[model samples]
Each structure stands twice: as C-alpha cells, then as structure tokens.
Target: MGADLIVEVALRHDRSEWSRIVPELCGGDAELEALVRALLAHYDRPDSPLPEGPYPVTLGPFTLDRELGAGAHGKVYLARRASLDGFVALKLLRPGPGMSEFVEQVRREAGRARRIPSAHVVPVFDAGRIEGGPFYVEMAVCADPDEESPGSIRIGRSLREAQPGLDPGEAARLVEDLARAVHAAHRTGIVHGDVKPENVLLTPETHRVMLADFGIATSLAVSVAPESAPIGTVAYMAPEQWRDRRAPSPSSDVYTLGGTLYFLLSGVAPHAGREVGADAPPRPLPASVPPRLREIVQRALAPRPEDRPASAAALADELRRFRALEPTWHDRRSVSRRVLLFARRHARELAAVAVVLALLLPLFVAGYRFFAGRVGELAAGEARLHGRIQTLDRSRADLERDVARLEGAAESKQKELARTESRLQQLPRLEQALGAAKEEAARSEAALAQRDAEAREAALRVAALEAQVAAVREALADAQSRERAAREDGATREAVARQDAGRALGERDEARRRLSDAEARLRTLERELRERDAALAVARAAEREALRRAAALAPAPGTK
Candidate 1:
C-alpha cells in the first residue's frame, strides 16, 4: 500500500475496525496488508505530552520562530513581524493568574524605553496581547537575526565564555556609554531599577552595549513609593536600595553601573551582600586597572548615595577622563595625592634622576676647590711682582745720589787748580813744580773717565729694571682676566651640575617608588603562600583520616 493511502485509511478507521478491514484494504497482498496494519496501529497510539509552557505558534502580528532564551516570568523568542521587513526580539510574558498586571508592567517598560532616544538603549517597536494567550513585546534585535547559530550575545554570557576579563580601558569606555544611556532615561524622569550584565546586550559586529529589560523602572513624576523588597539583582543593588527598599534614583543606577564595571574588570562582583557594611572592604580589582580608574569605580560603588557621583552623567564624564588619561576629580582635589600617583607611575625615571644627582654632587665640590686654589696662586704672584718693582725703584734712587756727590767733588778741585796756576806765573823759577802739577791733573782726568763709564752702565741697568716692571704689570692684568674667565666657567659648570642633580633626584624618586611596589607585591605573595600552606596541612590531615578508615574497613589478614 502507498504511504498516503495507508495514512488516509488509518485516520478514517478505529483500531478494531482497522484490524478487521486490513485484509480487504490490501486486496490479498501480504506485504501491503502488513504495512497498512502497522501504520494503523501507530496512528491509534496517543501523542506524546506537549512541551512545557505557552509554546505559541505566533504572538500578535509576529511569528515565533525559535526561543532565544527564557527566564522566570518571561521567554524571549526570535520572531518576525507580519508587516515589518526584519526580525525582532519578541519577549512574551508567561500566562498566569496575575498576567494582566504583568502585561501592563511590560507596556510601561516599553513606554519608558521608547521615550528615551539613545543608541545604547534598546528600542521597543511594539507590544500587545497574543490572541488568547499571554502578551508579547517586540524589540530591536542586537545581532543579525538571520545569521546561523547566533551564540550567547549578552554581556554576562560573553564574559563567562571568555578567558580573561575585559580590558580596563575598554570596560571604562563601555560603561561610560551605558551611563549616558541611563542618564538619558533619568532626564526623562525615569529610573532603570534593574541594571545588570545579563540585561545588557552586545552587538557582534561593533561590540556596542545595549541596555535592556526595564521591567521595574519607575517614573519619578508619578510616584516615589518604596517596594516591599529590593527590585534589582542583589549583588548589584545599592546598599540603601535593598536596606530600606527606598525609591529608586539615578544614584542607585550609578551603583549598578559601578558593579557592572567591576565585573568587567575583575570577572567577579565587587561584593556579595545586598547591604554590605561600610567598613567591609570591597574585592580588590585586578592589577590591570590603574589606580585612578580603580578609585573612580570605588567611589561610584560607595555605600551611601551621597558618596557617589551626583548623577550617571557625572560618572560617565569621570570615566571618559580616565580613559583619555586626563586628571579626574579625585586627582584634582589633592595636590599630594596627585604627586604620589605621578611618582608611582614614573618610578624608574625618578630613580634615574636620584642616581645622577648622587654622582654630580662630589664633582661640583671638587671643581669649586680646584678653582679656589688657582685664584689663590694668581693673588700670590701679583704680590711678588709688586715687591720686585718697589725694590728696583729704590736701587735707581741710590744711583742718582752717588752721581750728584761725584759732580760736587770735581767742581771744587777745578777751583783749587785755577788759584795755583795764577801763583806759578809770579814765580817762573819753579818750572819743574809746574810739570809735576800737570802730571797730577792727568791722573785726575783718568779717574773722571772711569766714573763716567760706571754711570752709563748704571743707566742701562735702570732701563732694563723698568722694562721688567712693565712686563710684570702686563702679566698681572692677564692673570686677572684669566681669573674672571675661570670664575665664569665655574659658574656655568655649577649650573650644569645643578641641572644634572635635579634629573638625578627625579630618577631616585622613581626607583624608590618601584622598590616599594616590589616589596608590596612580595608581601602579597608571602601571604598567599601562607594560606596555601595552611590549606595543604588541612588536606594532609584529611588524607590521613581517610587512610586510617580504609585500614579499619579492610578484610582481616588473608581472608579475601
């Protein structure tokens, strides 16, 4: 029998009737009759139980093609609108006793999402009741809905599937974008009561973040009533929010943003409690997060709302500055803190400056002493030259006195000879005596000639002494000029030394910072090692107990 004919006969007859009419339908063909009987028996059996919960074929104007995900109260489905050209994410509220209220909440969420105009906020297209079942809301899909095998695309899922947490810079940029979106909603008198990684979607191509799931968002213009309990994820909820169930505000959203950023940086939540103690320390961020950025996150996650940034926009601005390496509010507030942070960052440079200064100081001292000694030598040479010039002047004066004395003696002798010549004319008989007198006069002329030779020699000596004195004066002037030039050179060298010393001081500071960091790291490692050793001791004790138990339970001797 043909499959179509067998299916038709099985649908038309009951089990007992099919058993009785199979032979007649087959027309005496054994194989055809058996096949028809088997098909009839299979069609008579009851169908398997339907799969769980509101498996709708279509919702409103959209066809539910495949389930993207499901949660406690709702299920998200990949769907296509009847009149629309592209696919959309359709979230359906599960059918229950209080589904009407749930549907209204979803409508309110959609309204809130539609009011905000932000690229980071997911847009709601439409929402309505599904024929006779639960309600559905249509949203813009984050990824290519037509692509095959679209994997987990939410921020939480993506992070779980990756090896390391997101980079600090990238995480800051992403959170900044999200903060702007939250701020936009806040400006319209809306507060997203629940902001977490799971509700944040990511586009595959651009990796841009999109905020979704505003199920509990409240509008400040309408009411400020507190909920019975916290309305957001406990780990991400602000302390005041869960502690008193206070009305949600923009600051509460800022706390959640900080928690999300913490998750992105450390791959773990900052704290476990809904109402963590003020003194309780938060989980340390990874070393990858710079100190400035870490401080920003900590401030945003402050226990009290007043301690956090005033608004999500302000937080975004802080993160933007951090990403761009610009000084943040924390940095600008305290000069000392900024200097410390700078030193920590540039430790190596500061250390190098210190080394240079240490080396330059001694050289500067030695150069000063050397220049001082040269100046003293120049001063001493000037004093010696002055003394020599004074002595030469005294010698010239004494020679002039001796020449005057010699001229006086010669003039007196000439007068005496004139008187003797007049007396000899009166007495011509003593001619012989006149000859003797002439001889005496010739001896005196010889003596005068010798005295003139001595005078000429003394004049030459005085002239030579004057020339030596002049030369000494010129040498003294040159020495003074050289001393001035040396002093200037020393000043220049001192200036250069000071500059080098400054650079060295900077280097030394940098080195000290690096050493401090290294010591801190070593201390941390030691603490971790101690903890590991304690754990190992406990494990060894457990192993010993287990071995003893095993021995006690063993079969006696060789009784196997």
Candidate 2:
C-alpha cells in the first residue's frame, strides 16, 4: 500500500516541484517568469534529472563554493578569498549551450578591471579558468549590482530609479561627474563603453559620483565582434552604435552622458523607444532649459559622431564656460560647484578695481579746475610788458643826436674817402681770381661727359656677356642630357663634337649589347651540334664492326 500510494502521489502532483513553489511563482517578475517557463517545459521528462556536479569555478585565490544566484551570463557566488579571509561576489561561468568561450571571456573582463585606476571604478581582484573545464570566475569585493547605490534610495531601490527625479542642477552635476569619470578611464587607455545610471554610484553623504563596472565591456581595449551588437544597456546607446555597432570611443560615452542627463533633466527619455535616424537631425533640449545649457545637451546628443564633442575634456570645458553666464543655472550640485567657487575667489580682485576708480576720478577733476584758475592769474602780467615796450620807443631820438656829435669830432667824410680808395685797388686781383675759377669749371664739365660715355659702354658689354653665358649654359645642359640618354636606353648616339676640339670616341652600347647576346647563343648551339656529330660517328663505326662479326659467325650458324 505504501509503494502504490507513493506512485499515485507522484503521478497526481505537478512534476516541476510546482506545488512547493506556488507562492513564489505567483509573484513572478520577468526573470522568474523566464525561469519557470524553462523548467515547466522539461519537468515531465523521466530520462534527464537535473544535471549536477561541483560545476567547478575559481576566482583569484578562492574556489567557488556553490551557486548564489543564476543570472543571464552565469551564476553568482558568495566566494571567500582564502588568502585575505574576505568575502567577494564572484560570477562563475556555467557550462552549457554557447558557454565554452564565455569562461575565458569573463576572466578577460576581470583582467581588464584591475587596469582601471579610479576610486570610482570597481576593482577586479581575482580571475581564473577552471582546470579541465570551460568555466571562469570573477572575484569583485564590492557592492552588488542588484542593490541600491548610496545617496539614491530616496528615488527608489537603485540609482536607475533616482535618475528621473534629479533636478536640473543635480542632473547637470551628475552628468558632468560621469563625464569626468569616463574621461579618467579613457586617460588610462580604458573606455566605459557602457554608461548608464546603473553603472554610476553616488557616495551617500557627499553625492560624489563613482563610475562602476570597469570590466563589463567598458574598456576601449576590450575587443568584441562588431556585428554582435554592443553589449550595453540599449536606452543609453549612442545613435552611431545602432548603425554600425562600432567599438565605443570617448564621444560615445559623451552621448550616453547626454542621454542620462536628458532623462534626469526632463522626465522623458530623449528617444526612449526610437533612436534618431542616422540621417536625421538631432532632437532639441527641453524648452525649460536655459538656451546656453541646452546647446551643450543638444551638441552631445548629435546623431552623427563627427558632430559631437571630440573628447570629454573638450565637452567639460564648454559646459564650464556656458555655466558662467547662465544666471538661472544651478551651481548647487557636484562639479558645477567648483566653477562657482572659482568665480567667487576672483571677485575681490574685481571689487578693488572698482573702488580705485571711484576715489581717483574726483581728484583728477579737482586738479584740472585748480590749474585753470592759476592760468587766469598769469594773463595780467602779459598786458604790463606790452605797455613798457611802447614807452622805450620814444627815447630813440636823443640817441641819434649823441651819435652825430661823435661823428663830427672824428672827421667822418675824410675817413669814408680813404676807405673807398683801398677797396678799389683790390678789384684787379678779384677779376684774375674769377677767370681761374671759370677754367676749372670747364675742365670738370668735360671730365663728367667722358665718364658718362664709359659707363654706357660698360653697361652694354655686361648685357651682351650675360646673354652669351646663358646660351653656353643652355647648350651644356642639353649636351649632358643627350650624353646620359646615349649611356642608357638610346641605341643611336649623336656625337657632341667637342667645342674645344679635343678627344672624341664612338662607343658601342645598346646596339652592341644585342649583338653580343645573339652571338653567345649561336656559339652555344654550335657546341651542341659538334657533340651530336661525335656521338653519331661512334655509332656508325660500331655498326660496321657488328656487321663483320655477323658475317664471320654465319658459317658456324649453318653447322649448328
């Protein structure tokens, strides 16, 4: 009765252990829904029990104990590093359909994680492939991707949930911080190819942005199949990625940052379900955004890669400049606060310039008025000098009378006659001197004419000589060119008759080479023919001897 009852119960109950799981099944999410659908399809089979083993995997210094959670890529394990005596979250590659290469791949991701150098980037502590099996484990001693990151639980369960409620200023700061974090990764030869709110973690107290998941297809050095579709969250993907699936660059992260900010700044995702067509123009920023800030958001989200900021650093510089003039902009959040602080620091220097202008201008105006009053006092002295000069002019008549009395006492007329006679005697000497000057002038004029004639002749000769030299040089160049042609492929040579009438020779060149080659081939053929003749002569002589032997042996043949 026990055996019959057990068989009856097994047949009557559902095979998926569904009766034991009914409560959990009823609360199904997609992950649970997907899992149950898979199990229900195969539960009734009698031949295949659940496949089981150690399912061997290992992290850096620790071995994976057992499954903690089954995920899309593999199962997560709560692993402990034996060396450190610390627990780490490890993702173990499972062996099944299409999982052979996945183990090495997961280990490669973990290898990349160690290379990233930021406090924000999650550290990959250990990675190893299981011996004799296609499985690898990644040991990361960090927060779970499933749990809520700090400073964001106010929005909901995770950073992804909090993104939508972030105000314009907070959103801008977060986006800028993410840009900086991604740029830092790029500086170290890494690229956060996958950038979304979930990959960003904020510190609980400071709200400082932290970029997470450095090894999950986020490094520029990580190569993947271009046709395999970018292995990142779809909503934040740059439009260029959808068209070609090219490896991400700094600008690709820029586009994702813009997308994230767009969602945070406005409650709508820019193109949530649809990407801008590769040929379409970019969508505008939200109307509520300040014009200057909107321009930055639009430029980053441009559909074409060529249209976006060339680098994250370039975009950050542009944002800082724009934020300076944006009166409505909120500087209360993240990195934006630094820009405000910088302006505040320099404000005192600007205020000092203002205060100096106020004091100096009034003093300058008062000094100019005092100088004008002094110039008016000097005007009276000039009029007094003019009156004194007019009085002195009347005394000149008395001075003339004194001069006349002195001339009378000296007998002025006799003195004048004596002086005239002395001057007349020197006239003859002056005439002779004038005649000598005329002769010297005539000689100089004649010499100048002769020099002009000589100069004209010399100029003409120089011109003629230069023309002759140019012609000679042209001839020499042409002759050298022809000489080179004769040495090369030219068969016929035109002799350059030596202008100096010196040595000349005719050399056989291209034509002679052809003749020499032909004669050599003929000689080879003649030698071959002589060898053939000698062989023929020997064969004929042997034939003759064989005939004589045959004749001699004929009589013996008849006797036999």
Candidate 3:
C-alpha cells in the first residue's frame, strides 16, 4: 500500500489497532522522510528512485559536510566553520521548499542564540535565509569524524582512525562537564530535543565533549508538531516523550540521558540491544566497564520512565559517585597507554625483542617490579595531564558562555551601545569631511590653474599697456619735437606756442600712472592665490591622516 494508504488506514482505523502503529509512524526524520516519500510514490511505478536531496548548502562562512545523521525533523551535517577553523553540526528542515516555516525556525533559533550560554550545547553563531530555505551557522567543535553506525568515538587509535590518546579518567570528567552544561541550559529554560552519545563529542585534544544537533530543540514546553508528543530519537526517547508527549521536558531529557549513559558504558545500546529491535540485553564490555557503574546504568535504563532518574542531574550525580571509586579499568588503561609511549620513545633499544618479552607472562610481572619507580612517575604525569585537560574544559565553557551573552547584548544595543553608536556616528561624518577636503583640494588645484591663466592674461595685458604707454610716449615726444619745431617756425613767424607741448606731456604722465596701478593689483591677486594653495595643502595632509586612523579602527565593530 502507498504511505498515504498506510497512514489513512493506520490513523483512521478502529481505535485498538490505531494505538499499535501510531508510535512508529510519527517523528521527524527528514532524510528518511524524503527517501520514503520518494520510494512510496514509486512502489506502483518502479521507474523512479528517490531523487537525491537538495545540493550542499553554502551559507556565508560555513560549509555543510555530509549528513551526520537524522531524526524526526531530518538529516543534519557535521558542518565545518569555514570562516574560522571550528566545527558545528547543521540541521536542515524537513518536508519543504516553502520557507516561511524555515524562517519561523530561524527566528526561534535567533532568540535561543541570543539567550543561551552553555558550551556543551552547540553555540549558534549566525543565521540567515538561503535559497528558499533558512540556514544557521554555528560555533564549530571537534569530532571523531568517522561514525558508521552513529554514536561511537573509537576506543583506541588503530581501532579508531587518527584518534588522540586521552586519559579515560579525563574523558569521564568531560562527560561530567557536558552534564553540567545541559543543566546550565535547563536553568535558562531551554531543552535540547536530542541528547545522545552521538550528539556528545570530544575535542581534538579529547579534554571535553560538546553537545551537538539541537535541530528540534524548543524553548517552551509546547511546540507545534503532530499530537503534542514524540519528537525525538526513538531509541533514546523517554517514556513521557512517547506517552504524554511533553518533550523539551526534563523527563524527556532524562530518558535520553539514561540511554546515552547506557551506550557509553556498554558500547551497545540497551534499547537497540546490539542490533535494532533485539530483545536481549547487551552485556558490558569485560574489563573496560566498571561493575558498580553497571548497576546504576540498569536503574537509569529501567523500562518504565517513572522508574528512571528524575533528571539528567540525578543521572550525572550517580555517575559522579562511581567516578570517585578507584577503578582498576582506568589504571589498566593508564598502563597500556604508557607501554605504547615507552615503546615509541625507546624504539632503538626496545624495538623487537623487549616488546615481545614485555608481552610474555613472566616479564610482564618482572617489568612491573623492575620499572616500579618509572610507573609511579608516569601515573603522576597522567594525573597532572588530566588536571590540565579539566582546566581547558572550564576555559572553553566560559568562552562559549561569554560569546552567547555578547550575541545577546549585540541584538538590542543597550546603554553602552547607544553611547558607542553616538561616537560611531561621528566617524562617518568625519570621513565625509575628509572626502570633502579632498574634493576641495581638487577644486583648489583647478582654481590655481584658473588663477595662473588669469595671471598670465593680466601680465600680458600689463605688458601691452606698457608697450602702449611707451608708444604714446614716443608719439608725444615726436609731437613735442614737431610742436617745438612749429614753435621755432612760429618764433620766426610769431613767438610762443608752449600750451600744446605742455598738454601732451601731461597726458603721457597720466598713462604711466594707470600702468603702475594695474601692476600693483596683479601682484596682490597672485599673493592671495599662493596663500590659498598653501591652506589647501595643509587641509589635504590632515585629511590623509584622518583616513589612516579610520582604516586602523575598521575591523572591531561595536564598543571597540
């Protein structure tokens, strides 16, 4: 039957059978949903396979890697922070090309991104809309990077690929810190929808485990999903999550937490029982697991929800008590760790024979007695190293909390922001002033060009006027001589002709005075232009210096 047929038959059935199949039917597994819907639509028509999912999404500074795994909402990728070398898991929406719902989710995430401050919870770094879907970038974290069946970080290096050697004792501390991190989130009124071993990851150094994949996380106890119930990993699902359906609830997280611990301790999921849907309980790994821890694990894994620990806090607290006990498993892990290191360090001497001898039963006993002092030192070193790892975990947690708070403070820009913004407004105005100064300098240069043209024209006119005055003087001299000659002739003819010559001399004097006045005006105008050019040069130098200062202050955005 088609999935539509299956759903209609299953949901609208006589009430008794409806009760049986409903639990298995409703949940968000986006990848599975996409594939199943693709397959179901084609069962009658075998020409089609489910079309491949949408292409990889690139949102600003992050790149989505392959699908890490999926749940009720859908498949998620272990995203790398391409902007900064960090790790984050990105979850895409299920059942949509319509983006209003994705945008709604972005708004909810934007709010949580502003509010929460816990390291174990993957920090949401930035968000925006992308290609008919909404995507968010997050603070990337470290991972084992190769997970086949999901939720397994390799136990030893060769058994796991490129795994770092971390003291198991320290690894235990990290898990504890992760619990505290979730508890911190709970304090802020948020519930991580998915909490399981796969979601928990250690750093490159293996000092801490960061929580990932909050695709279905909710800030409120209520959210819009099918029937107000069953919106998380089924294997890790708490009974209340399935029964009453109040997820993002503490009880729901408590169920998942128990399931997580069960996977960690046993290396096989108690619910899945070594394979999907097996009835047998998986036995604990022989020497790797501590026994008393197993008893507490059994309590947390009780078939009924009410029978389990009330919250993650209680489960973490019980685990803490087990941690305080002196475990022979951790000691053995320490011994094996040293043997590897020793073999590597003293390769020239302990190359082939001693390594084989060390493995022998007699030398194993003899070597412990022989290198008793060295063993003691190595144990002390491991203890100190564990302390350093804890310190790093605390530091990382504090940094994440600080980042979350800063993102919140940035959104609504309070008093400090207002003051900073007021100062910042001056920057652009100053920049505009600098730009205007540059333009003014250019105008001044053009003005200088005009002034030079005017000066040249004035100088040419002065020269012309001087030439005209000289010509007039020459003509006046000729006229005076002629007048003198005329007077001479008149003396011979009639005696005094002085009035015409005196008038000609006076006109020549007037022309000389006018020429001197024009020269003086030209000198004054040239002097004024030179001063203006000097001032423009000074203004340009100041503007260049101001631009340099703005460049220095560019990257730091708010309150810097």
Candidate 4:
C-alpha cells in the first residue's frame, strides 16, 4: 500500500488518536495495519517522508529546489524566482478534488495579509491558482537565508521546538508580537484560525518570531466541511473551534495566542497533554510562570470566547501590560539607589552647597548674639559672642584642615587624571598596533584554516590508502592460502609417485630372479642330455661301433 493514505490520516487525525483510529480505519487489513504501525513508529520524525506527488521543477517564474515543510492542504518549497539570487517560500496546494474553495479563500486572505502593516506577519508576494493545476502562493521565507546554503533548504524551527520553557518575559514579548500580528489581520477582518507554535517561525540569527501560514489556516477552516471534523490545531485551538460552536473570530485568535504563550512558558500546550472538553477547565500553567503572566494566559485560554480578551488588540494590550511590569513597574529601583544616583549626578554642586551652609551657620549664630545685645542682655551677649567667636575659630580651623585634606586629595586625583590623560594619548598608537595585531591574527587564522583543510585532505588520503592496503592484505592472504594448498597437493602427488616407483622396482627384481632360475634349469637339462649321449656312445663303441652308423642311417631313413 502507498503511504499517501497514511500521510493523509496522520495529517488529519491527532497522533494520540492514531492507535484507535488507525486500526478502526484499517479494519483488519494486514498490509495497511502493518504500514500504519510502521508509520506510527516514526510519523512525527522530522525526516519522515510524506507521500506527495512528484515535485514540479518550475512553477511560473519560481524554480523549486526542495520542500521546506508540508501540511494538510499544501506544501511549502524553498524556491528561487527567475534570475533572483535570493530565495522565497513557495506554497503549493496539493492538486485534488474539492480544493477550489480553499484556493479562493487563500488567495483572498493572503491578499489581505499582504496589506497587513505588521512586521511580525510573514509577507506574501503573490498568490494565484493555475487553470488546471494547484494553487500557489509566493511569500518571503520566514528564515535567514544564510542558515542554509543555496544548495539546500531548511525550514525555520518552530517557537516551541526552538526555545521551549522560555523566560516569562520573553514568552510575553513573543506572544505580544503575535497578538499584534493577529490584531493587524483582525483590522482587515481576517481571523487567524490557527495560532500555534508550529505557525510561529523564528529567524536563526535574531531568533525573532514571525507568524507564518497566516491566511492558510483560516482558509483551511473555511473550506473544510463543519460536519467532517473541527479545523485548527487541537493543542492550541479555541474551545469554540473545538465545539464548532461558532466561526473563527479575533477572540478565538486571542485564545490561541494565549495557548502559544502557555506552551512557551511551560513547554506544554494549554490543554496540557490531553484534549479537554469545551466545558472542562484548562489545565493550570506551570508554577514557575509569573503570576501576572499566568493570569494573562489563563484569560486568553478562557473556554468562553466572550470571557476572553475582547479582541486580539486587547490581548496584545494585556500582554503589553504584563511585559511592561517586567522592565518598569516591578523593576523600580530602591530609595537608596535613587539617592545614590541623585548624589552622583550632582556631586560637585552638593559639596558646594554643604560648604556654604557650614560657613553661613556661624554668621547666623553671630547675628543672633548681636541681636540679643541690642535687646538689653549686653554682658551676656558679649560673653556669648566671645564664646561664639571661639567656636567659630575652632570651626574655621576644622574647615581649613578639611579643605587642606580635600585639596591634597584633589591634587592626587589630578595626578591620576594626568596619568589617565597620558594613557588616553597612547590610545591611537595602541589602537593602530591592535589593528595590526588583529590583521596578523586574521592572516594566521586563515593560514591555519588552509592548513587544517590540507590536513583533513591528507587524513582522507591516508584512510583511503589504508583501506587499499587492507584489501591488498586480504587478497595476498587468499593467494597465500591457494599457494599452500597447491604445495600440499604437489607433495602428496610426489609421495604417491615415489611409492609406485618403489613397487615397480620390486616387481622387476622378482621377474629378473625368476628368469634366471628358468635359465639355470634349462642349462642343467642340456648338460644331463649331453652326459647321456656320451654314455650311449661309449656303450656302442665296444659292441656296436659298426651298428651305430647303420642305426643312425636307418633311424634317419625311417623318420624321413
């Protein structure tokens, strides 16, 4: 079975429901059941393949390179427009039946989103449907181009995946930015049906969150039949959306923004791990979240849309208020810090005022004594004046000493200032030298990088040579084994040949001995015959010498 069915099911149903839903749909078909099991094993993997149609090489002026991400209705591609050096995200709706409404809604809402005056919203460049093909939207890629080379494509990581459990202040700031984007859309009568973390993309360098798939989700919600299943992400969908009780509104967007914030603050969705009924209370946020922010999120996640923020703008304002407390209301300095800062700003002026007050205090006392003398206590006034004079003299002496001490300190400070000025004068030369040093370091680093590259090349060559050597060793061992086997065979053959030769030699010796014995027997028989012939001749010589010749003649005649 093809994975298109599995991919469709995965895109449609929640993963938590796959266990029951897959078997129920498969209905005992082993192939689909096994495929579903395999898909479930790694469906959520980033590298999992979604069985989409063959990718188009070029759509209009855009040359498609590779897919960045996929969704229920469409897939986004990292593509290059004609003759452009930069890249843009090209979203193409999967060509199928019953998608014309979605295509129209997307074209309309994306146009509206294009007019939105918010920097946080991903900008749309163009959108149109082919006469007999898929609908397409060209938009600014919500990522830094430098993140991936021109040779490859990368989707910006979602907010939840990139920076889960963010600081409360950071979470608030991000949600506030999202709310502002939503508010911008709301102004144009476009309600973002889905505002989950997956729709929020973060730039690689600045990590600035930008809302993506702005009109796409709303288009999906509008185009999808209400009797089928509710639209939007379940984890962050508003209660009204879950119940299909009403159409998407700015308040529903506010609820999703709150859910996104909750996910950021606690690394989990507002519903926690499980889906909640429309009547059920939302799960509490993590305790570590700031109380004020928790309250803000809770209000945004309210089950009743009417009880939530009046609009996305209102939600943004609440988030702004919570964020303001981070750096303003709760960040106020203590009284002591305020005084210290005030003194630091007016140090010289305060010193002068203190000195003037100290000097005038003596004059004020003297004036009082003089007035008393005029008032008829002349003797007492005179004594008091003398005492006052003495006290004034003592105070004057103390003041003089303090002045002298201060003067010495001031002189030391002046010397220090002179030294600092002398150092300041060397700054230019130091900076020049520093610049030279930095240039030299950069050159050295470049050289080192080159050397490292060469070293890596050499290492790779060495590894290749080592692999060749290993192969050669294996071949040599095989050849050696063959040679050894050949040698053993040769030895066995030689031993057999030697044994055969020995047996042949023994047989020849025995035959030669038997022949000699036969020859001896023949010779013995010949000698015996000769002896008998001689005995017969001796016997006949006496009595039948004359008869021997006649008998021999007669026997010859008879035989003839």
Task: Give Cα distance to truth, residue 375, candidate 2, Å.
Answer: 6.6
TM-score of each: 0.47, 0.43, 0.39, 0.47
Displacement of the residue 310 alpha carbon in candidate 2, Å? 1.3
lDDT at 482, model 2:
38
TM-score of 3: 0.39
Off by over 4 Å in 2: 1-97, 127-158, 218-230, 275-283, 320-560
Task: Give candidates' CA RMSD values in order.
Answer: 47.6, 45.8, 42.7, 57.4
Best-first order by lDDT: 4, 1, 2, 3
Q: lDDT of candidate 2 vs native? A: 0.52
lDDT (10s digit) by residue, model 4, range 240-356? 777764666788888889888878877777664435444445677778877667777777777887888888877878777665443222223356544554676678899999999
lDDT of 3 by residue, 267-362 (tens): 545456322544454455346555556566666666566777666676666666556643222223576655654565567676677677667968
Total colliding residue pairs, candidate 3: 9
- TM accuracy, model 4: 0.47
Q: Write the per-residue lDDT of candidate 1 for residues 1-560, one digit (tens) a residue.
A: 55335545555556567666677777788988866555545445454121233544655677766676665556777677889866678877543232334455567777867888788887877665665345566787767332454543331223223316467887888889999999998987778887877678766557678887654334211222234755676777787866777766889999999988888888876656434544244688878788899999999999999999999999999998787655688988988877776776678899999999899989988998998998899889989988998998997787667545434433443343344335324333333443453354345334433443344544444344334434533443443354345445434533443343334323444433543443464354446435544543443344344334333333344342
Q: How far is candidate 1 from the true structure (C-alpha RMSD, Å)?
A: 47.6
Q: Can you tell me which runs of candidate 3 are displaced by over 4 Å?
A: 1-89, 97-99, 126-128, 133-139, 143-171, 215-225, 273-288, 303-310, 326-560
Score each candidate by Cα lDDT.
0.63, 0.52, 0.51, 0.65
Off by over 4 Å in 4: 1-61, 83-85, 129-133, 145-155, 227-229, 272-280, 326-560
